[model samples]
Target chain A: MKYLPLIWAGIWRKRSRAILMLLQIASAFVLFGVLQGLDTGVSQTIAKQHGDRLYVSSSVAMGDPLPIGLLARIQSVPGIEYVTPRADFDGSYQKLDQFVPVVAGDVDSFFKVYEELKTSPAAIRALRNDRSGAIVGILTMRKYGWRIGDHIVLTSGLPTSNGSHDWGFDIVGTYDTPDQPTSATALITNFTYLNESRLTGRDHADMFVTKIDSAADADRIGLAIDNAFANSSNETHTQSEAELAAAQLQQLGDLDFIVHGIIGAVFFAVLFATGALMMQSLRERVPELAVLKTVGFTDRRVMALILAESVTFCLVAAGIGLALSTLLLPLARQQIGFSRVPDIVFAEGAACAVVLAFVSGWIPASRGSRLQVVDALAGR
Target chain B: MSFLDQTFALTATALRSMSGRRGAALVTVIGVTTVVGVLISLLALSNGARALGGSEASPDEAVVLGSGAASSQQSVLTRDEALAVRNAPGIKRAPDGTLYLSATTMVSVDAIRSNGKRGSVALVGFTPAIRLFAPGVKLIAGRMYRPGVHELIVSDPLRKMYRGLELGDHITLRGTEWTVVGIAAGNGTVNDSILRADADTVMSAFGRNTYQQVIVELTSPAAFDTFKSWALSNPALPVQVKTEAADFDDTFGQLHRLLDFVAYFIGGVMASGAICGALNSLYASVDARRRELATLRAIGFGGGPIIASVLIEGMLLALPGAFLGAAAAWLLFNGHVLSTEGLIFTLTVTPGLLVVSVSWALAMGLIGASLPALRAARVPVAVALRAT
Candidate 1:
């Protein structure tokens, strides 16, 4: 209790040093928070996908289209409850850089598949009645300044497009999902309209979505379905929601390693800078530390106090950094668009920053503690 | 002794004394190493991509894109178009006047996991004559297919990523059974992730009648002028011809530039914070050694040597840090190959990256040490000595 003044005086004596260290820690915390939030949000979005839902793609590859005739065969698969077959018409939004996922699904089946969608019955009816009507995510609606019943056209960079951008659809209803904010990056239209108008030939559905009674039977059901088509014209590969999400992420290549390397490099640089600052600060205070020792303070006690001071400084800085991070995320999301940034949450990662901040301080604190009082007094 | 000489001696003495402070020296090294290492890794990523994309093509070669195909994936030509291209004027031909032309298709395939993991693999179907268009591609094992056989060649990277795919291993692709009869290497192009096969086999399997792109070789640089004018004169001919190097650059340039921008943008922002930390520490070091500097000044040491000494010490500390950082980055990312969208590329670490990293560290040290050196040099003798 008596050492409160000493701790306060220590900070006051090197206010600039303390402030600089705090700022350093705060910036690191902010970065960690935002990055972690993004990763977490992307995962959570995928994980939150309706557990009952399943996606069936070509056993051969994702890019290959499944025969439209296979939709009924998939629907006839044993233990299958409901099925929604979607045809992927790959296109871009108004901007060339932005990839807009255009999916053609049965209206009733899609509504049934996404049980969490909370929309007026009239809107759902409106979507179902018009063949060319489209349904986009809530975030997507905000992004493109589109309203219900607005007409939107999408262009394909692929050679299949006619003069200008090939296809257009009317906006019917805006939807939201806790699964992934970026799911709004896609626009869902009627499969019937797509098949009748733009699409040609036997290749109809890109993939089929199936829902079952229990997730425990997911593997068993997936195997049975794949086995059903093993020797047939169009082979199938059925994956769980998680596996599909993982496969999509895998397209980005070794994300776990890449993200880790990036974060590790960034943090390593931050730690180095902090350690140097702390060492220099401690060296300057050697005489002061000696004076404290002479005044009957034990080395261990002095070390603990310094460590505690550092931990406190780091924690405070991290808190400010986290606060700043939360503020920055919405703006970043807005600027980068929902497809890239999504709804990123930073709470859990800020906790990690707090721990890192203390660890960074401890290295220098331990060195400061090991100083010989006599040498320190003699200005060595 | 002259005042300047004395100052230089004092400055050297001070540096030697400071060098003995192992703890402080270690801290400086640690700081500098991290800054340098990170900067180098980013440089490697950018330059490695550039080298891969840039050094892969030949100068005399030309890439012919079909009228509708803006990208390699979109470009497809009929047999007549390919033959027309081959017979075009000034096309570099063998002594028999046979042109160096290869028609190829580029398609992306999903690699099925024998172990339940999925990966992307690029599928390139080319004629046996593809060797002429891509001279850098080399077969490591087995032999090229006998023209019409269902034999396929796998890239070295493809062999590593997938299972049961070796020389003579059979794999079904696009409902057609293909025997992996050979292994090939691209000249650091995206083809490293591809499954190379006969062009006819690939086209028939994928249900495409036309070729994706055609590569043609011209005899001389000046021939391109006549070729272009003649080609433009026939407006109905839906083929755009450009140097093979230019087409490859255009194909991957946007992506490479995007990655470079990201690496630099993120790195630059992070470096600013690190620099701030360096400056603060140096300022503290100079302030603490006030009496030490003042005493040297009182003994007839001048300011210039003092500044130089402090700067040198900071740089010395930084150089070790830079090396440490570079070594660590190399240990982590060097030769590491991973796939994205099915294209495999090794995280190329080169000697040039290390030099860049160390140079960056040295620069940071010089900048960081300047103000502190100035403070140490300008310290008032009486005031510094009078403190405690």
Candidate 2:
């Protein structure tokens, strides 16, 4: 504890070299913080998702349309709270760049199944009464400067029974999910309106979302639901929200391999740089280290001091980098749809910094401790 | 000495004494190698994506889509509209006088990957003239799928990637069984990840009466404007017309742009860190020669020569790292196949990428050596000489 000043002095003995090394290590940590933060943040969000919600889709493929007739059968499964049919279509409003995803479903049961989406009861009633009325997500509503009672026409890929590509909807209300703003980008409308109008895939839904009664019975209930449709034409595979999200992410192809590869390359270069710098500085301070040994500092104490310097240097640099990433995460929040960098990233970064310091400083610290006073004083 | 001569002399001296500071110099070499290796490898990935879109695109072909459709997948053209586009002016005619026009639509079919994971692949329905429109697409195995038959020809890359795509394998979609009749090579373009079948057969099986898009080969690249104007001016056809180049760009631009952004962002951060390492190493190199530099300054050597010499040494140090890194990246990742959003591309380490790696390495060397060079040039001759 009393030797902190000595270690600090050793680090700053050449201020320019120290500062440059700090910046180098700090930039590596910046990448570490951002990438690791993104990875952990996504996994944590998936883990914290409502385990009681299950998505039932075609067992054959992900996007294959499932029959809405199966909705009744799924609802009759044991431990089911609420079931709603969902079908999403792509639409563009006014400009091709302004993309709006429309989710066609029963709003009454849909909102009940997805309780996180907050909306006024009056708005839900209005959406139910008006067949052609639509409830826009708060984010999408704000993007196009939409208001209630405004008639907006969207061009969809799917053609209607009347052979028109454009579909008009009266804006009934806006819904938002505070915890996840990106989820608030969907425009919700009645499935019956869509089903009766669209030319293809009528009476079919993309999936059936259900809320289960208990988290522990989710797998059992999902199995029961799948069992009923086991031999049917449109066989269903039910998955909890977490499992579904994980599978979808997995389809993006092994992000762990990429993140690990990049971080490995970064640490490899930094490790060499740190080791070289420590050795270079230690060589220049040999005479001084010998003088310290003569002044009654133990050989072990000298080793500890060198190790202490590297640890403090790496930890401080990593801390700054992690802090920088934390500040920059909000800018990525909109793009990646994550709330923030997870706190676990900082802990992980600190742990990595300690290992980095220990490995890089090992040889230099050992050489300093094993130095003979007679050879060191003689400038050998 | 002349400034040029002085610079040469100073560089020679620094290079000669580099062995004394082997550890520091190694740091710079390793740092630059890592930076350039990472940069080149990622750039190669984006290059592969560009190749995916650019390989089969030609300026002498045009795409017609339903008006206001954001993408071909969304566009819907009726039989009349498709016929009208076939008779449009400026379309190329084969020797048999048949127009080189094809109308196509696609249905998304999920295929099990070789690893037992689900991957969505497109099953495209093409008109008979598709062979004329895309002559670059040719059979690699078995025979071409006959029109009016429920047969599929899967792209070679897709056959290797997904199961149930081999020749003679039957794939059932929505209760209809379709046989795979052939394997085709799509010239490393977007078509490499799709299955092809007859337009009429696919439409009937999928209950679709409309074609999504119509593509026509123009007589010449200059004829594109004429074809576009004719398609847009006619009231009978509510369609959008774009040259094949523009269509490809619009289809694959987002993926390429994202890949480029990620490559450069990661490359930039890594380069900055590597430059810092170079700077520290160069500083140590100069510090090791403080007494010698002071003696040279005392003998009337100009500051410019010292700066130029340090910069030269830095670049020289970084050059080998560049080649080594590029070689590593090429050996490890070049020709590696990756699929994104159902499109397959090979990682290409082209000669142009070598130029990119070398330039980045030299820049790191120059920027890293600047401050250290100044410190060396402005060394206090009397003080340095007296202290050391």
Candidate 3:
């Protein structure tokens, strides 16, 4: 504790050199914090507690169109709480580049199954009363500047019985999810309207989702639902909600490996730079270290001071980098689907900083300690 | 000596001194390597996507899709509507009165990946006219699938990415078994990601009542405008017409743009760190040679020569890392097959990507050298000489 000022002064002996190394180490941590934060957030999204929720899609492929009749059969299965048929009705707004993701289902059962989606009962009733009424999400509303009671026309690839590709709806209400804001981008409508009005793909749904009262029975109940139509032409692939999300995220091409690859290369390079700079700075301090030795500073004590200097420098740099990352994280919220940097990433950054400091500073510190006072004083 | 001569002599002298400062020089080299390697790896990915999107796109070919459809998956065209497109004017006609057109439909099928995870791949069915529309597609193994039978010919990449896709294997979808008859290689287009089969058979088996889109080869590139007006003339055919290139753009341009954005953003952050590292090393090196440079200045050498020499040394040190980094990325990732968003593609490290790597590395080297170069030119000769 008494040598604190001495170590601090050693780190800043040459202001320009120290500052350059500081910037170098800090920039590496910036990449580390951002990448690891985003990576951890993605894993958290996959690791969200969806144990009680179960998804049933076609065994052949997702979006393979299961019959609506299967929805009732699955609902009748034992231990099921609520079930809703989900169908995607993505459309293009005024411009072809603008895509509006609309989900069609029995709004009453759908909202009950997906309790995270917040909306008023009036909107549900309106969607039921008017087949063309749609409940748009708040994010979608803000994006297109839409107001309730506004009539909007969206063009879809699916054709109506009249051979028209246009689907018009009256915006009845707005909805949002606080926990996961990205889910708030969906536009919800009643399933009956889309199924009955579509020209060819009628009486079918993309998938079915059901919730169980207790998470303990989730796997057994999911299997029972799949068993109901195991050998039928429309076989189902049942999975827990979390498993489904993980599979979807995996479809983005082994994200963990990519993130780790880039991070690994960055660290490898940073490690070499830190080591070289430590050695260079230590070489310049031989005479001062010899003077300390002549004044009866133990060899071990000299080594500790060198190590302390590195620890202080690297940790301070990492702290600055992580602080900046937390501030800039929100800008990437939409892309990475994470609003905040996870706490574990900050902890991991600090651990990395310590390890880097120790490894890079070890040889230089030992060399400084092992120097002969007489030889070092002679400028050897 | 002239200014240029002085610059050359000083640079040579600095190069001679670089051996003593090998550690600092090594740090700069390694810093540049990481920045360039990562940048090129990502650029290579985006470049591969761009290559796939634009490769083999003929200006004379036109794609017709339902007006509201964003991609082929969302498009739907009834049989009569598709026939109307092929019957329109400006379509190339053979001597036997056949039109150069192919109506296609797609169905997503579940498959197990090599890693034993559930994945999906596209099975697309094209009419007999497909041979004319895509003349470059060829069977790499086995034979072409026979029409009116449940047979599929998988693309090379598709077969490599998923299991149970080998030739002679049977795949069951919806209680129907389809035999894999051949392995095909495409001309770096969307078809490379999909398996091909008979259009009518796929539609009937998948319970699809409509063709997703119709692709036609025009008599000339100029014929696209004529075909567009003709297809939109009747309200019965509510379809959109675009040159094949534009259609490819609509299908994949956004994804490529996204890849490029990610590459540049990550590369920029890493380059900033690499610049800091190079700067620190150059500073150390300049300090090491402070006495030597001061004595030269005291004698007669101008600051201009010293500055120019330092900058050259920095770039020269960085030059090898640019090649090594690009070479490393190429060796590790080039021609690697991967999939994202249900679209399979190969990572191709092109010559153009090498150019990107060198430019970024050299830029980092130059920016890192600037401040150090300036400080070296301004060293106080009298003070430095009298010290120590």
Candidate 4:
């Protein structure tokens, strides 16, 4: 085609500009990649906890713990198979920077209720036999460099002073979760180890995790549990596990809006900048455009050439940005931890980049093609 | 040959040339403006957040978390413990001999956002000393709430984030509805997001009979060692004493860091697109000006002046964009309330932010124009003259 030389010459003439365009595209892709990665991480965390389970706690909020005595009352209710009570022990290792999750639960009931935690038989037996035994998530163990038999002393941030200052516990086993956010950060200890110990208060349990016999009656079962404790001193709030997690995220407040706004603003900046550049480039080639027009080139051909160039530039930049983003994501994860950034990501937003480029390119390309051949020739 | 004459000549040439290539110049300005606008807006947010997150409390003011409590809200102290803390040494006395002590508790609430979206909001119960510690809290809408009444005074940010937060609107806290009687403004601090109510009302509603943390204004900052030693050594009551500013940092440091990372990360990505736009436009400008540049060179318009002219043209385009972006940001976000967890803050676009944004536009222009300017200057006069 006659346009092939024009394309080659156009690109060859502005080598630096072309190279910069590619770099920019690559960088944008990287940014898009990271944002998608973070979104994926959040979604994954939420997805990990989704199951046929329901949570029962104080109606006020998730932080408000329900009484331990409500477990048996729930077990007796119809469509409820088993009830496992877990106490939230808010303590940390040495410093506040290091997270130490001490979840107190009856080992047998917890194991029966949730089969996600995979541990050794001997370790489970040892945990059951010992009074102050604990099973740490595999990721937690790896983070702290703790062995199976290591005796860890966790300092309490929650008030509890019964001659046991720094609570000592023997690590019995390292367990893994089904989908891996289980070890994102948290250490699970036995309920008896906490309940029998003087650490727990009279009426405090982080919440109760219950398994219903019928999946269909989850909402009904939640309502029934709430109804049971409706008039009590501490009213109960019950919802499916998904709802509970969603409610907790809702507590994060306007994060989605903030994120959406930021994304919109960033995209606006990208479009404005890129559109301006493409428009200027098309306009500057007025003489070349006029020559093409005089040689029987249609306005459509002129538009296509400019649009193609714009798309080529954006696609090059996007590809480079994405390549860099993928390479750097692993390093970022290692530095920040999996809790902050996940391993997997989605590239669905690339569609957004393509659309942005097309629209931006079209605007200037149209303006350039619409220029009169006579006026364009006069510029020379 | 005079410096001013040369500068004037340069300006004339730059303006005339830019006018000739008005279409290209406009594009360059648009691109640079966007880059500058976004960069400046983020900086403003970062500045606003930092200013608010910092402890405006007096240097002598100290807070006490429970023996094991890492967070200020998680610490629980009993009535007896509060009394003991009041009697402790190093507590500054008022003219009336009252100890400058305030006990507070914080609870995060699930709230509805302005867009009818659900969000987290924190509620705080504070004694009268909360006013003493934070003087920036000014009642803008209604009167300061009565001490014993179950009335609440919300910050402006909260008022913006949550719907139905106007005066006389009832908001439920700890399962009990409290009437909003006033709207207060904190100096853009973290407290701007809280719903402030009577201490007893919060305590009773949450069944937290025990106080979360005891804050006491010390006699002097120098007495911190003595005060800390005495408070920690107290066998009767175990508590940890830390500066108000340090405590604020501890509470929201990770959050601020996370936000900063997000801003920079997004900005960096967007900047890449902007940079590409700049390069393309500048390269085209240089190519189109070959004849004009050759004439200028023939007339002793040195390569330096020509390059400077091009850079000035780029900056001219970019600086306007910075202001435009700032104007847009101000119109969109200024005075707008946004919530996170239980805290709220208004998105502020200050004058300083505008300056930063404009400067960033200038930077984008300069960077974008440099390569093209260099290439234009490097063009052989004879070759350029024959370009047409």
Among the numbered candidates, top lDDT falls to 3
**How well does chain A score by TM in each candidate?**
0.81, 0.97, 0.96, 0.85
TM per candidate: 0.84, 0.95, 0.97, 0.87
Per DockQ, the best of the predicted structures is 3
- lDDT-best of 1 and 3: 3
Worst 10 residues of 2 chain A by lDDT: A246-255
**lDDT per residue as tens, model 3, B4-53:** 99899999999998899899899989989988898888888887788766
Candidate 2 vs candidate 3, DockQ winner? 3
Clashing pairs in 2: none
> On a 0 to 100 scale, what is the lDDT of residue B86 in model 2?
75
B74, model 4: CA deviation in Å?
A: 3.2
RMSD of each: 4.5, 2.1, 1.6, 4.1
- What is candidate 1's lDDT per residue for B150-196, written digit by digit as tens? 77788876787788678989877656777888888644557676788
How many Å off is the CA of B279 in candidate 3?
1.4
Instruction: Tell me the spans in candidate 3 whose CA falls farther than 4 Å from its real position.
Output: B54-56
Residue-wise lDDT of candidate 4 within B1-388, one digit each (tens)? 6445654686576677666666656656665555555555565566556666653656887888777767775666766777788777888887877778888776666566777765666678888766655464688888877677778888876787678788889876545778889998666787777888768777777666667788888889987778888888878676778988787777776666766775666666666567666767777778877787788778777777777877876777677888887887787677665555565555677787777777777877888888888987888989888876
Candidate 3 residue lDDT tens string, A229-316: 9888899998888888888887888778888999899889988998988998898899999999999999999998899999999999
- TM-score of model number 3: 0.97
lDDT of 4 at A14: 54
Query: Which candidate comes out best when scored by TM-score?
Result: 3
lDDT digits (tens) for residues A210-320 of candidate 2: 998898998899899888987666777799998887766766666677778788999999999999889888888999999999999899999998999999999999998
Model 1 chain A: which ten-residue window has the lowest total lDDT? A157-166
True contacts kept of each: 0.36, 0.47, 0.77, 0.56
Model 1: how far is B75 from its true place, Å?
Answer: 5.8
For model 1, the DockQ equals 0.32
